[model samples]
Target: MDWQQILTNVAGEIIAPTTAAYALAAIGLNVHFGMTGLLNFGQAGFMLLGAYGYAIASIAGWPVWAAVLVALACAVVFALILGIPTLKLRGDYLAIVTIAAAEIIRMIGRSTSMTEVTGGNAGLAGDGFKGSFQELSPLPDGNFAIGPWSYSMNLSNSWWVRIVGWALVALACFLVWRWMNSPWGRVLKGIREDEDAVRSLGKNVYAYKMQALVLGGAIGAIAGIVYALPRAVQPDSMGRPMTFYVWTILLLGGAATVFGPVLGSILLWTTLMLVKTVLRDVIPATVLRSEQIEMLGWVLVGVTLMLLVIFRPQGILGDRKELAIDVR
Candidate 1:
């Protein structure tokens, strides 16, 4: 294997639109858990609904804007569905219900009965769905090179996706930062610290929680849109592992910080890519199979999470004060 080629491929993924997509989703999670103290483990469900909502609307000949609106609407509905019964409950219950609900959504999408609509296990195509977005590409149709890394302007279909994806990520980050610094954001922080106290202070704790869920879920929906833009939409793409990955990004970046999610995503993905590339190069091919290397990467992530929890639970940019929640 060409070691140089491996490094290049790894680097590409590190900065790819997908990384930004995850960052956006993790920022949403930061709002839910880091700020509001909501234990939402079903972020994948919101993402799935967003992806499917847009794809299905496009398939039905709706305008791009309408499709996006439908996706956002779906996210709101999902939030209401999950938040109505459990938002009043304690932390662990909310986590359990949300996680289970997310899995149920994924499994239902993969079911054969819904194959006609969801494409079932085969996934759905985005042929016309992405056309409108792609048409807005500002770059000329050709190749562009920078240093040892070069990318096709029009060849891989990633140009349009990257443009829109990065744009949305920037928008989400800006909105999150602004919101987190507002009076509403302060209430969220107060709720995270002591919901009962906020309620005693004449604040509507339940309403605040619901609003946080809706806003965070909406952000997750946008992440789903960006994530599915570059490729086909598959149910498996929004699996439990995806939520775990988002959580990892949130924690890695310092959950309550404005820019933590973005930085954490870039750092985590880059480190993962670099490790895979280096291991692929130095590890004796004769000793370890390709599949083994893949497993080894996951093992490393698990060990890293363990270490983080034990040592620096506040994450890279997180403050110990921000993480002081009364989950009990």
Candidate 2:
């Protein structure tokens, strides 16, 4: 096994744009599940809408800013549509509805009729929407390296994407930290603890729930946009597995903590890369195919999640007290 290559790949994934995207999405999930005790299982739906919204807007000649606005608007609309009815319900009902809604959104995106607008199953290519983003790159157009691991800053147009995407992730994390410490944030915590108590204290629980939904959905939407920065907007990419991965990140990092999601993203992606690298190097080409390596990585993730839930349901940084939920 090439230990240097494995280390490099793990390091690269730790700082990759996709890691930041998942971090942002998981943070949003933290707000819903950890802070407000809302069961939002359709985070992928929010991401899908954001990706398609941006893609469709660009295709329709809208500016980047306008496209972003449209995506945010779509997130708000989706939140309201999902939250209005199910947010009032309790427990697994919300989960069931949200998951169903997400799958429905994915199917619609993959449908043939929406192909012209959404690019259908083939996915939508960026029509120069990334140009303005690329123009902001400060690094020179060449490969740069610290040691055994090196990468071309200009290769595949991803340098700029990583730059912008990480910036957005940082900004989102800062905003979430600030929001969680505010008075409004206190109310959210209270609602999580007991909505009835909050209602008795004269707070509008429903409004707060709706607001949480909207905010969390908007963050997820941003994640969707960042996730699509390195590739085309594909419906399959926004499927159930994406949502599950975000949840794993949320749970692994310690949900209620400000930095939990980001830390979780880094750790999870690093593990995946390390696994793939080690397996590829050690497992002979004749013994196991590359596809088998991919499957093994996922199996590791599943096992990790199961262990976390059973042994440390509170997550790495999570408080056991904060995890008190009346799902009954």
Candidate 3:
């Protein structure tokens, strides 16, 4: 109800570490779906593996570097396993396989038998894992303000995550932009437009597909590690909805553009938070329950998405040429 509080929420959403995490995931999605023309509907699976791998390694007393290595390794392995069998399949088969694979990973995390390792449905606590990372905070414990924005190291205490997360996002975006400008990146675009033409030109289409899958999955895994660093690694957090949200961010910004994911994430989260804030303030509690107000916020988001697609299918930053995909 407070206008100042609502404005803060809207502004903070774009700068939040969570937004950076989603931006990283969307960047990975851009590599697969945007540049490579690969339909990866199970990005959440990549995140799940990365998060759990890091958490498990930490619980096993692994150092931060080793735990990160294990997470990236798990993501690559998962991509290979998933891509080798289904990358060659045509017509939404990859999408189906990826979605199923994501669900399978989630189920594995939630399985009763893996409780000791995965923490079952309750998920793994970071108390045993976050020490090494938290110890590396550069900012001294105190309150600090940067112009209009205020931060407290001891209060909400997410300044460290924000610093690391935004740095990684910037680095990831730079790397993606560099890769997509190379010759190898051209083949990815070719495969997306017309795989048959690319294959006829003697290019290894399958190999390229596999490579894209691996790279994107690996990035997704890194995003997962970033995501989990600020919170507990929960299996449910890496579900289908998460993948959809990543897709939304990618599509909203302009899928094939180098900075689209970053822009899209900022816009999408800002709008979502803005809507939630307005709805919670404007809507009377007597008319709608708290949960219903939340649902209405999402509904408004869906309506906005529909309007965007109808008016500009290429997205806010996407060129029509970049969206010329051959579905066959």
Highest TM-score scorer: 3
**Model 3 Cα lDDT, one tens digit per residue, 1-328:** 6888788778987778789989999999999999888889999999999999988998898888899999999999999899988998865987898999999999999999999999999999867677777767777887777655677653233787788888989998998989889999999999988899999999999999999999999889989988887788999988999999999999889999988999999998899889988887788899988899888888999899989887888889999877773334
Residue 317 C-alpha lDDT in model 1:
83
Compare the candidates by lDDT and give the number of the best one.
Answer: 3
Q: Whole-model lDDT for model 3 versus the true structure?
A: 0.88
Clashing pairs in 1: 254-318
Comparing 1 with 3 on TM-score, the higher-scoring candidate is 3
Per-residue lDDT of candidate 1, residues 202-223 (tens digit): 9999999999999999999989
Question: Per-residue lDDT tens digits of candidate 2, residues 1-328?
Answer: 6677678778988778899889989988888987899988899999999988887886777777888999899999999988888889878988999999999999999999998888789889754455544545687888777565566674433666677778888888888889889999989999988899999999999999999999999989989888887777999999999999999999898988888999899999999888878888888889889999889888987798889878888788887778772323
Candidate 2: list runs displaced more than 4 Å.
Answer: 136-143, 146-157, 325-328
lDDT comparison, 1 vs 3, better candidate: 3
TM-score of each: 0.93, 0.94, 0.96
Where does candidate 3 stray beyond 4 Å?
152-157, 325-328
Runs off by more than 4 Å, candidate 1:
1-7, 154-157, 325-328
- The candidates, ranked best first by TM-score, are 3, 2, 1
